[model samples]
Target chain A: MDIIVPIKQVPETSNVKMDPETGTMIRDGVGTVVNPLDLYAIETALRLKEAHGGIVTALTMGPSPAVKALREAIAMGCDEAVFISDRSFGGADSWATSYTIAQAIKQAGRYDLIICGERATDGDTGQVGPGIAAWLDLPLATYVASVTTLPGADAPVGLSVERLVEEGYQILELPLPALLTVVKEIGSPRLPTLRGKKRAKVTEIPLFNAQNLELDPAFIGLKGSPTKVVKVATPKVMRSGTVVRAHDEAEIALAVDRLLAFLDERGLLPRGDRP
Target chain B: MSFVWTLAEQHGGRLKDVSFELLSRGRALADKLDTKLASVVIGDGVSPEQLEALIRRGADEVYAIMDPRLAHFVCETYSNILSHLVKTYQPTIILAAATSMGRTVMPHVAVRVHTGLTADCTELDIEPGTGNLLQTRPAIGGNIMATIKTPQHRPQMATVRPKSSRPLPEDATRVGKVIEVPLIESLIDERVRVTGYRTDTADFVNLEEADVVIAGGRGMKKAEHFGMLHDIAGVFGGVVGASRDAIDRGWLGYSHQIGLSGKTISPRLILTAGISGSIQFLAGIKTSETIVSINTDPDAGLHKVADFGIVGDLFEVLPELQRRLHEHAAAPPAATTATADDERPDERQREERV
Candidate 1:
């Protein structure tokens, strides 16, 4: 089984904060990291390769800086990493991004499975994985929690996986050459070893651009995106918050009492203590 | 006439509340455009009353397609049917609730039909002069809001957050046309099979249905501290929830997670502790009636949206609040402001148990 895992580099938003005085965002200290979700995808691919006896290839499409994500993937056990970078693919949306990636994957030769993060942290759209499946005409499964290869190991017929649904969990059996978008529940991603890090630092990341993939000019960038952002603005802050502060035990007790009284006024506190 | 279509969602033989909410919103949009509002119901054993209920809840027309294949949601089959409907009807707009089913099927249909779709939209509007559907959603992790438009797509599509709008009152006397689509097995691809489903029995919080939610975030520091959150939730007869960060940290299960990638909940009241409040998480609780936050950071983003906030350590604040609530629960009913008719069964159970 040859598995291809798509990853991306995204701005770290966990510690992103706004400037108090200017009200503008302070992005100086916030650096780019491999999208947190994609780590799970890479780990899933590596696990599949380890069990099924095939090579895991990590793929990504972005500016040249995205090679760092590929290196991280290599350090995490990807046999090889492919980077698709070009000026033409700069401003692509989910649709065009998936198309570009699908084209690149096609140029990378044969693969049995493709794995992707459920959604990117920065875009949070979650359309790319499904879009890639559609563009490639491959069977797609989203929110797959666990995947097990069926009985036919040599030429795997299909996969049995547990899918997370809204109500509960559903077990699904899908045929081969399918795409899966995974969540954090898949598995714990492993840290890179010293030897792996050393090998990854010198590993050549094969770079493929739009020209090399021979992607259609119209379908490679912002021009290919159907949706356009008409406006962007700061969200209006609606609630005017009143902060209750407490320093010591006495103040803490008093604060809890006041909060209970507030709940009482709102009918949220339990009414008429029973038994 | 131009039509605004809402894809009605059903599970366990009952229509989801979001389906009705979407129809209500679609009706308003259709009225604004001087068009018709149509609803499509896809399921097995859909009764006539269920189809009529759609008309009662503001659908001008109901398209019911029944088949055993669609009894359970198969993404490929449903997306194929929806794409076919969109192509044949050529509706001006299509709306679906941003639940797991909608999020899965709508994108497939959009791609099949070669159109664009906006996911988890919080606001929808019709642009004047051009008469295009304007989809507004929090972008870049809620730091900014972006309004998107699919100018070239025929059926502009969006997946809206559930409980974001009020459903129209049901009118028993109202009547509308019901068109039944004949199901063909050849059109359905039966690759995936549903083996079985199992709900989490022990950790079943039912966050979406909970009246009150007590959520913890990354600041809780460890998985064991979630017990503090659970204890506080127990006091209020509420359920426990967590942010995506906490879930990622393995502090809580995915079922309790509330965020863009998790479940969207609109509880009557939500109390969040130790959470810094990312926009992605805020998106899930946008429709919550009352929000309260307890965090050590006074300048946390959660404070901006919270109706009330406390600046302190969650570990300290949680125990203090839990103690006070326990004391109150132990106290007799001295001065009851609640009427006998107003007492909720869950509160009574909590009182009896505590």
Candidate 2:
């Protein structure tokens, strides 16, 4: 079972700080890391390759810089790597992103399963996974908590998937040639191996662009997106909080009592003792 | 008639709530677009009864697929089934509740079908000019609203967060059509298993359905301290609520947490004590009809948002109020003064159990 794991390098959400003045995220000095959720997808593919006998191909659609994420996937145990980077692909929404990745998946051409994170941290819109499924016209399962393959097909891979169902989960079984958006509940991701690390440093990733995909230019970026962000801004402060200081412990208790009375008047206190 | 495609989500040998919710939302979208609503159900043991439910909910046609291979949800097989349906029908839009399963599976379908998808959307609007969906949702921790569209993609896809779309008023009398799609062997090529199933059952009411919500913040201190909040909820026949900090600290379950990353509560009344009312959280439950707050800090944001504010320690006020309310029946207060904290307690609070 050859599995393709698509990884995306996103801005470190932890380092993401809003510029109070501009009200936009300041990504100038913040570093980038592979989307945290994608880790589960990569790890799941590696586990599948280990259990069965197949190679894991790691793919990414970003600038040359995204090679880092691919190498990281290699260091974690993928067999091959591909990079689909070009200026035209920048600023693409889920649609273009899915098209680009889907074309690349077709380029890879012979995979039993495609694994991805449930969603991306930057967009938080989890659309690309299903978009890829839509583009590839393949079966898709999302938020898979667990996976176990079934036996007896030439490209044999039967998955018993524990899908996230809000309150709990729903178990599903699907055959080969499927796309799965994995969840952390699947399994713990493996640590990078020394041998794997050695291979990652020297591997040269294959790069593809719009021409390689033969995709229409108008449909590959902001232009291709059905949804356009007419505007993006931070939420304004609706109300500022008030601060009250107690002069002393005695004042603190008294202040509390007075406030309770105020709450009582407003029904903040459900108890009706003070007439 | 324009085609309407609904992703059939089956769980434990039945269709999930979101599936019906999707059908409901799909019905509205279909009516707006002047299309017929169609549903697809995929599972190994899907029953005709389940198909009837989908029709009752609003599906004009039900597509059914039964295969032992599909008894379990393998991404590859189901995605294949849905893609086939979409290709066959060519619907204009696809919507799924932003539940974990919807979030995960929709992306795969979107990718394969070469479409666009919006995630966790709170609202869906159809563009009058293009007939494209104007999918609106909160972004960046609910700090901003984003409206997305998929211009060229047929069956523009989106996943709605649960509770954002209310279940349409159920009317068994409402009628619709049911069409069952033929089944094929699911394409499954992966290694995974289902060891056991355990559901998270809260001792208290699930906050989602509670009429009254009482959330505790860092002020409450420990996991066990949630007992106080729980106790308070019991007094009002409500459910306990928590802040993100409480849930991340494992002081409360994610199910009970109310914030951007957790559940949102839009009850008739929300009584908050010791909560700071961060913007992210405010965005989550700001839709409540009335808000009453108790905080030691006079300048806490919670007070600003509260319809009525009290600046003091909750520990003293809450206990005393509970005591007084236990004394006797408090006369009905004016509708404007819903809580009526000043009124004397009534025998109702003190009523003993048999």
Taking the tens digit of each residue's C-alpha lDDT, what string does model 2 give over A121-229?
A: 6566777876787677666667677788878755465677766544455666666787888865577688899999999999978888877777778778666665555
* Best candidate, DockQ: 1
Q: Using lDDT as the measure, which candidate wins?
A: 1
The residue-by-residue lDDT of candidate 1 on B138-197, one tens digit each, is: 666666666888899779989887656657877778878999998766768777777776
Please give the distance, in angstroms, between residue A174's alpha carbon in candidate 2 and its true position after superposition.
Answer: 6.2
TM-score of chain B of 1: 0.82
CA displacement after TM-score superposition, residue B336 of candidate 2 (Å)? 16
Chain A TM-score by candidate, in order: 0.86, 0.84
| Separate DockQ for every predicted complex | 0.47, 0.24
Screening candidate 1 with a backbone cut-off below 3 angstroms (N, C-alpha, C), the clashing residue pairs are: none
- Measured with C-alpha atoms, the lDDT of residue B331 in candidate 1 is 78
Weakest 10 consecutive residues of candidate 2 chain B by summed lDDT: B345-354
